[model samples]
Target: MQVTGFVPRETADLRGRAGGPLTLRYGPRAVVVVGGLPGSGKSTLLRRWDAPATLIDPRTTRLACQARMPAALPYPAYRPAVRLLHLLRTRAAFRRPGPLLVHDCGSRWWMRRALAHWARRSGRELHVVLLAVRPAEALAGQRARARTAAPRTFRLHVRRTARLLAGIERRGRAAFPGARSVLLADAVSRGRLAGVRFDAPR
Candidate 1:
């Protein structure tokens, strides 16, 4: 159960129970959906897992807009259209056989439905990881990250991002009742996931 290189910074201390090499009981293709507030370490976990995953990040699009356009548009104004396009493109690209695909985005109900529909059609297993950190911790992380990277208005942007994630989670749970969901920190602390097929890097 030793996750080895697959544990994130927040989960490093919890890796003392590291066991033998990791193995998965199931062999089906998977779709890992990661959801959390702005600074819940979703990107860290995604990189650690190192699965064949597609990262559909709304923030990237916002950054792109700021880079390409003269006027910096707010993330809220541009995210929906960009997300829709990404979803359509992802569905098209994933029509063929490949490794597990992970969607690293806010877990909104509509987005979950789109993902689940693709999974069901492709006969792929779906695993949802919800990163939940304390509000204060999350805010602190957001502030620190914003200091280095944000384009404009750090505090307001972080607050909006947190609110957006909360709404997405609220909607996602109501929509996808059967998908496996776990808190990022808690799941890592537990060492191994229960229902999902998680294999170590080979």
Candidate 2:
């Protein structure tokens, strides 16, 4: 059987991943990818984030698909189309000059590998912003939002998220092998991450 990835000791020791102050260390021309499970504040954080960067989010594509499609049609039915559009848009944006801040689902290894490869090939620094919200809190956040994920989907996300966190704790800096930081919902609410600023274009 194929084995899953393992986390290194140092990456697991990051204080930020444990709800402590996030460390921000980056070089010029960096692409920061924000990732987390559903309702883990990835979207919420990016919406208010601003920096000298291009934002790539699949939700925009999904929303555009919703606008052009029938209201009664279920989102899951058209998700493939939305994802295709998002991929197209992302590929196009990858060629553009400037830093990029990508909102992503961290559950997929392929997505992470792609971003890492692109950053390496382009001579750009790659950074990961991981949202580390608890499963129960993430579920609560889904309810607080106007749209909620299906229960089964949410459960799947929770399982993947748990594994991701475990990997981070076990792997250390090598967990992502690039600049990495973690954000906890509770910590953000308490103003613990006041030093870090991520602004979105107005």
Candidate 3:
């Protein structure tokens, strides 16, 4: 994993598939955004984190919306409402105190920009943990979890996620203006990573 911003460099050298448990440490007021393609183990990774961060996962809002809506109502019928509510909840989270660990798909520029804005205004640093996975792997992950997306929707997410990753590579630090660090983790590296931690700044 490469650390790409205002922090001291700590090269993870994960390309070699080095074996060991790894933890990402950040400031107590950091906003660590976990992102990947749909069904790319983002939720699974977030769930493994036992850090005391304020968890902000879209699944939480989506499941709540699903419960409140009629069972006959298809997901498409309430996806918009779920998204809106998730946005509102994410915005509100930035107002409260403490570290934040958010699950984002990394495809929505608007949401990321909004998060950047909040992090900047609140004197907090924004960081990203991007899980770069193959579409085939992601699809298998979806199947394993029994929560597959429509083929069309899944394709769109893959395209968007690919483009986002490309942009991050092409733009470097400019890809995320307010981001203090960007950690790119492939399957091998991700598997070795144990969790995240928030500590007082040295």
Candidate 4:
């Protein structure tokens, strides 16, 4: 698997410290999974990419639900349904190919394995862009966005994100063996990410 510079340091923010923007190109039938803790700026980076891809993000599902339901309802009450819908949409998007970007919490090992398996079986390549943001920064991002997870959930995400980072540091390419992985090493900014795009290979 191809990798950009830096094997990911434990407890490091992936926005600024990492070298230049790491670009990974793939066939038009590939899917790119952007994984990180909430508020790690996955959506922000996707916007920077500005490429044509199926974007699978839970927040989009939440906004759609909010339109039909009361905004006063807590997210926990609808999270299960939202996740189910997101999964269904992901399944459908994978059927049609161009390029796909999936914004996801990188905590689920089983789901990652499943995606790896599917990519292998379908003869499509899967790539991962891991944003290793520190937890405090992630919380700040949540606060900035005016939506935050419950304390317990936030802690869980922190733990899982830390673990993923640790694995990346320890195992390098083996950590995410199924795909070519790119690690953004510090907090991201518009200036830092300028000229970044995930163009499909011709």
Off by over 4 Å in 3: 1-16, 200-202
- Specify the poorest-scoring 10-residue window by lDDT in model 4: 3-12
Give the C-alpha lDDT of model 2. Answer: 0.63
Question: For all candidates, what are the clash counts?
Answer: 0, 16, 0, 10
Q: What digit string (tens of lDDT, one per residue) describes model 2 on residues 109-201?
A: 667777777777777766676777677767777778867878888787778767777776676435564544443233244223322233222
Q: Write down the lDDT of every candidate, Cα atoms only.
A: 0.50, 0.63, 0.79, 0.68
Comparing candidate 2 with candidate 3, which one achieves the higher lDDT? Answer: 3
- What residue runs in model 1 are displaced by over 4 Å at the alpha carbon? 1-28, 60-68, 71-78, 103-107, 147-184, 187-202
Query: Model 3, poorest ten-residue lDDT window?
Result: 4-13
**If scored against the real structure, what TM-score would every candidate get?**
0.58, 0.76, 0.89, 0.79
lDDT of 3 by residue, 24-69 (tens): 7788888888888877888888878788989999888988889898
Question: Compared to the true structure, candidate 3 yields what TM-score?
Answer: 0.89
Measured by TM-score, the strongest candidate is 3
| Total backbone collisions, model 2 | 16
Worst 10 residues of 2 by lDDT: 1-10
| lDDT per residue as tens, model 1, 1-202 | 3433242211122223434343222233555666655565666555555554455555555566567654666656766877676666668645656445454544355666777788777776555565545555555656766633343443554555466545534664333433533233333333343233334222
| Residue 60 error, candidate 3, Å | 0.7
